[model samples]
Target: MIRYIKNIFLGIYCLLQGMYISMLNMIRPKVTEKYPENRGRKEMMERFRGLLTMPHNEQNEHKCTACGICMINCPNGTIQVISRKEPDEATGKEKRVLDRHLYDLGSCTFCALCTIACPQDAIAWSPVFEHTVFTRNKLVKQLNREGSKLEVKTGKS
Candidate 1:
């Protein structure tokens, strides 16, 4: 009977201890974000790896020549460079131009191999991680912007 009373007190003491700790934690400053509601607009890290992209200059020009170097270097076949013979700025004759540069981010390993293989420095990593979508087709993006032309190197200054 004495042991029973002591056990009851011990159990109550432990319950109170747990509740006290929980209460203290509950009143403390929040340790986690509220997620979607409180997430930062630009939350990507400096070195964060994301979908590969082709950067256009202020004048909206890219350096991709459709050399297929990146495509050849990609181990997973994630890159496909489409090329066509198009008229240059000065010449009427046909010249190789990049028609489309497709990037399958879903299959990409983000190994940076394609960027390293690009001699023209056409492709690079973008910090935009909000590219998530419902369908797989949305993940496969064409790096070249629509209606945008490549930057043709004409002459030496």
Candidate 2:
């Protein structure tokens, strides 16, 4: 009889403790984002990796050397670096130039290996995460812009 009474008291104490916690939470400010309503004001965290991009300068020049390192480093076959032989004006010798840099967003795991492995810092993650698409073909992107040329560093500092 005594043990039963003690169990009842313990259960009431536990119930009161739970209620206290619930009351405390109810009085606190809401942390849940309003989502669609607050879409304009919504901001992604700084470290969020959304998509891969190749940055170009004001002169429409990029630092990618078409080394194929990014493609090789990718765990999946998400990156493709196509190159073509062109005659260098200064040396008058055949040089490999980047014809295209293709990135398949559909297959990419966003492991960031390609960006990390790039020796030229050619690739980076874009903050824009809106990737809604009707077809998978749309996910494949050409990183290099038309008429964009490789930015070669001049004299060593």
Name the candidate that leads on lDDT: 2
lDDT of each: 0.87, 0.93
TM-scores of all candidate predictions against the true structure:
0.70, 0.84
- RMSD over all Cα atoms, model 2: 2.3
Candidate 2 residue-wise lDDT, 16-62, digit = tens: 99999999999999989987798768888877889999999999999
Misplaced by over 4 Å in model 1 are 1-38, 154-157
Scanning candidate 2 in windows of ten residues, the lowest lDDT window is 39-48
lDDT of 1 by residue, 63-106 (tens): 89898999999999999999899876576888888889999988
